[model samples]
Target: MSSLKPILLVEDNPRDLELTLAALEKCQLANDVIVARDGEEALSLLTHRDPGSGEFTLVPAVVLLDLKLPKVDGLEVLERMKGDPETRHVPIVMLTASREESDLVRSYQHGVNAFVVKPVNFRDFFQAIRDLGVFWAILNEPPVTTRRPPASTYAKGV
Candidate 1:
């Protein structure tokens, strides 16, 4: 069987990204954390559209989405993910700097599995990421899909 797919991290801020990555690393969950600098890039990675190859199919274990992303923005990405049947079931946690009630309401409204407001303090940020990693990567049981049997099962005995 193929290895479990990586966890997608949709964040654009370099400093925040580094801190998040460090925190995840401390928890040892960073191994599968795939970083996307913006919402557009995040979408492309999730959709598996290789600009050169033209093939488009990717499904990750989870998506840690930042709300204030460039171009497409996080809410739009969340909307797209929830709207698409192929990608709808994947867990998405909204991570944002803003504590606006409107943003929180909209995030939950759009089907975000969790909403986390990133703290400006480094220690708090670290703790948040560690907790986030533990909850999503260790505690959560991701939705299951039926797997097909190997093609060899249909062949005659040697």
Candidate 2:
């Protein structure tokens, strides 16, 4: 099996999801692209500790998160992931169609690695996703995380 880590894509819109997937495919990235239709699903894929107890655990190479989502919002998801030691080191890029400045500010405040406004035109959006896929998946080298201690340990500053 390939050691390449998968990419978590959290998008609720069907068309947008399809387009993003296609763009990533065009990028020809070897890493798998996992889909999470909502914030809840994204959180489950990222967090879900205790493998023996049957909790889901997936630390993706990166997370492309949308701002507006069903159930839980992206900012909350970012906050939770950044707040947790298990997933904080994982990079997250906010990919959204929202032009609101507040959204951008809040995303940065929540520790998002990058914030990208989804382009309106088809070709632009496609190229944007392709560039993002190539950069984050193929070009960017992530930090090696060999140790995964319990969250409680970090709470005690150990």
Candidate 3:
């Protein structure tokens, strides 16, 4: 289930981010949770290169992305990621406060692995995030990918 892989959390709201972090911590998952306050930062982290090895560093097993975001929206991020073979296999879960059916439909159409509506109740939201952490990070089996292929790989029709 790629337990060693990290979990990427892309959230713009500070309160939600804190709650999610706390919930994940309660889960006691061995996987590290990388936080990005916005979609742009999330994408940057995903494609960040290591200074030592010159390789991408944020190849996570699962990405918990928020629907509405600053700079690039969640749907745009989802589309870009899904369009790329390198990141296409990474499971993306839409964790948002939006209850719009259109948003859910759009998310699924864009290939989001799961969509979770954030609960208004603090306890409910905490438990939901904890459950997600346990399932996605511990129980769910993910594809094995050391690192995604470079952009050039796509250019040659790979």
lDDT to native, each model: 0.79, 0.84, 0.84
> Where is the poorest 10-residue window by lDDT in model 2?
149-158
How big is the positional error of residue 110 in model 3, measured in Å on the Cα after superposition? 0.6
> What TM-score does each of the candidates earn?
0.84, 0.88, 0.87
Q: Any residue pairs clashing in model 3, and if so which?
A: none
Evaluated with TM-score, which candidate comes out highest?
2
Give per-residue CA lDDT, model 3, range 50-155, as digits (tens). Answer: 6776777667768999999999999999999999887899999999999999999999999999999999999999999999999998899888776753432211
TM-score of 2: 0.88
Model 3 segments more than 4 A misplaced = 1-3, 51-54, 148-158
The worst-scoring run of ten residues by lDDT in candidate 3 lies at 149-158
Predicted structure 3, TM vs. truth: 0.87
Residues 61-103 of candidate 2: C-alpha lDDT, one tens digit per residue: 7899999999999999999999988789999999999999999
As for candidate 2, its clashing pairs are none
Using lDDT as the measure, name the better of candidate 1 and candidate 3. 3
